[model samples]
Target chain A: MRFRVFVSLKPTVLDPQGQTICRALNGMGHNSITDVRQGKYFDISLAEGVAREQAMREIEQIAQDVLANPVIEEYQVELLEE
Target chain B: MRFRVFVSLKPTVLDPQGQTICRALNGMGHNSITDVRQGKYFDISLAEGVAREQAMREIEQIAQDVLANPVIEEYQVELLEE
Candidate 1:
């Protein structure tokens, strides 16, 4: 099984790195961009024979416990088709 | 207008950070995880009155020229509905 995990900062949090990117883009003349928030993602592959239900359960747990810092970040998981 | 941009290393590129994360997870007892590839994403908000076509054009350029290191990374852009 494979999953895509996206981890982003809570909307309320400040994102300096994203701001820097925005500034760089504007400087490059792509001024239409007003704001940018950067985040992390993971493409995860599991061992074969893992059941879908169990894969979902474990992937969610991995996302919540290992991939994200729940205090300021939120994560979403998407199971991929074979 | 808003867009989501995902940037990931080319499949052939080495991803040490993702490997470290995988090792950590395995060491922490989540042994089912076989591999992990990490990437970056951007949530971009554009100024009002920017047409969808232009937003798409400009966001793609920004992603291609600035957000991703095209030599080793690839990026995808998705227009988002408010």
Candidate 2:
């Protein structure tokens, strides 16, 4: 199975990096780029036969405990077809 | 249409962040975590009726001109069905 994990700052969090990018974009005349949000991506190719449910459960745990700070971050998990 | 762009360091590049994570993972006993890589993700929602090819070409330009350091980074683009 393949999984793609996106971990991003919550909307309420102050994103200095994103702000910088937004300012740069506006300066570059891409005024339509109203907002910029920065995030991390993890692409994992797991061993075959790993059940989807088990993978989800483990990934959820990783997201909550290791990949993100629950107070300021949110995560999305996608199970991709192999 | 929606698009997801992934910008990652080339395998030949020295990834200090990934090295640190690898060491940390090893310390945490995830010995199977032989390698670690870090990357950035951009999720973009475009205006309706945009042609996929146009969007892809624009994104490729952005990836090459703005989001990625062609010398050390590589990118992948995926058009997500809305």
Candidate 3:
């Protein structure tokens, strides 16, 4: 089984990196470009035979405990094909 | 209009950061986990009235020239409903 976990900063948090990108885009004459926000994702692979339900449980735990910093970041998980 | 751009390292490149995460997962007893690859994504907004094809063209150029390190990274763009 495989899963994808996306981690992003809380909306209330300041994202200087994203701001930098926006400014750069504007500087490049992409005047129509209005905003940019950046985030990270992880593609995780699990051994075969891991049941979907159990994999969801474990992957959720992994996303929470290992992939995200709850105080500033949030995460979402999606199951992928076998 | 809004779009999402996902940027990831080429499979051939070594991802030490991903390796560190794998080690941490294994240490945490997630023995079923086989691998993890990390990547980034950007949420970008463009002013309304920009045609889809034109937006795609400009976004592609922005992605190639500003967002991605084409030599080591690749990018995919997804248009989102306004």
Best by DockQ: 3
Give the alpha carbon lDDT tens digit for every residue of A1-82 in model 1.
8899999999999999999988988898888889999999999999998889998999899999888999999999998753
Share of reference contacts found in each model = 0.94, 0.25, 0.94
lDDT by residue (A1-82, candidate 2, tens digit) is 6666789998889888877876776687554444556789765445566667876776566567776788989988877555
Error of 1 at B10 (Å): 0.2
Tens-place lDDT digits, model 3, residues B1-82? 9999999999998888998999899998999999999999999999989999999999899889888999999999998766
Q: Distance (Å) between predicted and true CA of B74, model 1?
A: 0.6
lDDT against true structure, model 1: 0.91
Superposed Cα deviation of residue A8, candidate 2 (Å):
0.5
User: Which 10-residue span in candidate 1 chain B carries the lowest summed lDDT?
Assistant: B50-59
> What TM-score against the true fold does each predicted structure earn?
0.94, 0.74, 0.96
The stretch of ten residues in a row with the least summed lDDT in candidate 3 chain A is A73-82
User: 1 or 2, which is superior by TM-score?
Assistant: 1
Interface RMSD of 3: 0.4
- Write candidate 2's Cα lDDT for B6-78 as tens digits: 8999989998886786577568654434455678977655556667787677667766788888999998887
Q: What is the lDDT of every predicted structure here?
A: 0.91, 0.71, 0.92
Q: What would you estimate as the lDDT of candidate 3?
A: 0.92
lDDT order of candidates, top first: 3, 1, 2
- Write the number of the candidate with greater DockQ, choosing between 2 and 3: 3
| Best candidate, lDDT | 3
